[model samples]
Target: MQRKWMFTFILLVVGFMVAVQYNTVQQPSERDTRDIWAIRNELAKERKLHSELLTEVRALDETLDKYNASEEGNKGQALLETVEDLRQQAGITEQSGPGIVIDVVPSQESVAMGTPLHEISPELLTRFVNEVNRFKGLDMDIDGKRVTALSAIRDINGQTTVNGLPVTIPPFQIKILSPDIEKSEKLYNFLQSSSILDDFYLDDFILEINEPENNVKINGRSDQSENRYLKELPKGG
Candidate 1:
């Protein structure tokens, strides 16, 4: 998961860097369009891989839940308790705690109804999502959706169009769970330091954790690769 985050960040940075210089360095006119297409293709491929991994993770979690339930009084009971606590607190009847809500808006809030398709670019969206992920406990998905490992970088799944309805493009609205105000602010500030924040109006963000909770769940990934990777590393020998 950590590797994927870094990979995604690098991809986003590259995309933005290209977008920044797309027109200025107008020397190679013929290959310009082709190069842009190649970058977008790479982004799509990464999204597909992430999606596949996410599905695997979700399936593994289901299996763990079933096994945990059967072993009622086993040694893993404490772990089960933690999972249950996280789920309930993440969202249930009610949750009273400090959480951050990031509101992402288009470059122009009022882009006239009939504005052309090329009005906003994808790099803007990538930056907004990256900004949210910079925080220790914060991550996001499109609106209420949870970002699984396989979430796509671009809305279309490498397809030009599907069935009629269009895919989502960012300017994403992110909701994050942040326990500490100071740390959360630090993360937000770091994001603003980057030029992406300047491109959009971000006053809509609200960090409301006044109703703090005594406990917050730590819902971890179901992948065993983490353990394997660490065990195989140099220090493990």
Candidate 2:
């Protein structure tokens, strides 16, 4: 009876050990299943982060494109403004402001003396223009022809010409535009006391400078010919 009891107790101990081993093996499988679920969750999170990163990158690219486009547009606008300003400075555009009108006509004494209406000398006209320019004439026109820096005022075939165009005898107009009302007033005052009038009188001509008008228009230069000798220089040279 004692040996049987001992054998039974050994069998019970062996069964408990097998049961513990089996439980350990089953716990590993359950742990493996849980690990798989955790791995799937981590993968899903990584994919979501990647998708968000891609979205942010695309948004940044669109913003960069808009910024580039805006920069280009600003450059274009600045170029256009610069060109327009250059045109104004070069006197290629029409200008209007407060200024005076000068009428060159035969003097009453000369007309009464029966001196024939003769074409005013180019030298006299040039001197008059120089005087006006000295007194701050911003823009000028002789007989409706605009005078530019390159204008030629000389005699061609015994006819007085301004910018290669003939001026009508004795009653032609010279319109001058000043920068502002104050300058126009000052110019008018200077002309009133100028010696250039005496020079015109010597040439049997009368220069009549009218009062300043608020709206005086000077037309743009008619000649738009480009200089053939003016070539664009090489970059940085």
Candidate 3:
């Protein structure tokens, strides 16, 4: 009887020890999962806050526009306005307007609307735009209108490919204003000599401009130029 009682005690002790170990193992596992979930939640909240800050910074771009009214800025704005006016007179679509928009196409015809010789590369176009942008109020566009295009010319990739679809080209549309064709032509020659037009070897690009009008609009909108916000308020801010 004593032996049987002792045996029963040993079995009970073994079962209790197992139960304790199992419970202890489960507790740590549950705590680990909870800790991981908490960490992820905190990270998500931080990411949302970071995105909000970025949006706030971009909103300041319009409010901080203050350089468009300077003397140098006015000249650029003037040049661009002339281009647009000339383009309108020439009957080219809005795509062909003032400031500069060069589109290069690969073609044998001097006047042929040819293929894009080089594939579009974002970096290449960006450099070209930056070079042109240094001119006070110079504006740019591609295919259509622009508030401001990160790429005056665009492509899907970072590099240009020959077999790729017709990519960025120039005079894609250009409009300029001059007292006469001579003056407008002079501007075109200046652009070439300045090496501003040296990036792409496009084909059959045409330039059009109209005679200058003194009362013409100078600055079309605020975002067209690097210096677009400083114009004197027209009686009101």
Candidate with best TM-score = 2
Off by over 4 Å in 2: 1-70, 229-237
lDDT tens per residue, model 1, 82-155: 56765543432233234455554444544544433332233445555665654545533344444433344453
In model 3, which regions exceed 4 Å deviation? 1-103, 107-118, 145-171, 174-187, 202-237
Q: Model 2: per-residue lDDT, tens digit, 120-209?
A: 898998998888877533889898888877788998999988778898887888888888989999999999999999999999999999
Which TM-score value belongs to model 1? 0.38
Model 3, 165-221: lDDT tens per residue?
233444344223334444444555566665434444342232232333232222222
User: What is the Å distance of residue 198 in model 1 from its true position?
Assistant: 3.8
Best by lDDT: 2
* TM-score of each predicted structure versus truth: 0.38, 0.64, 0.30
Candidate 3 lDDT (Cα, whole model)?
0.46
Tell me the whole-model lDDT of each prediction, alpha carbons only: 0.50, 0.85, 0.46
Report the lDDT of model 1 for residue 166.
Answer: 33
Which structure is stronger by TM-score: 1 or 3?
1
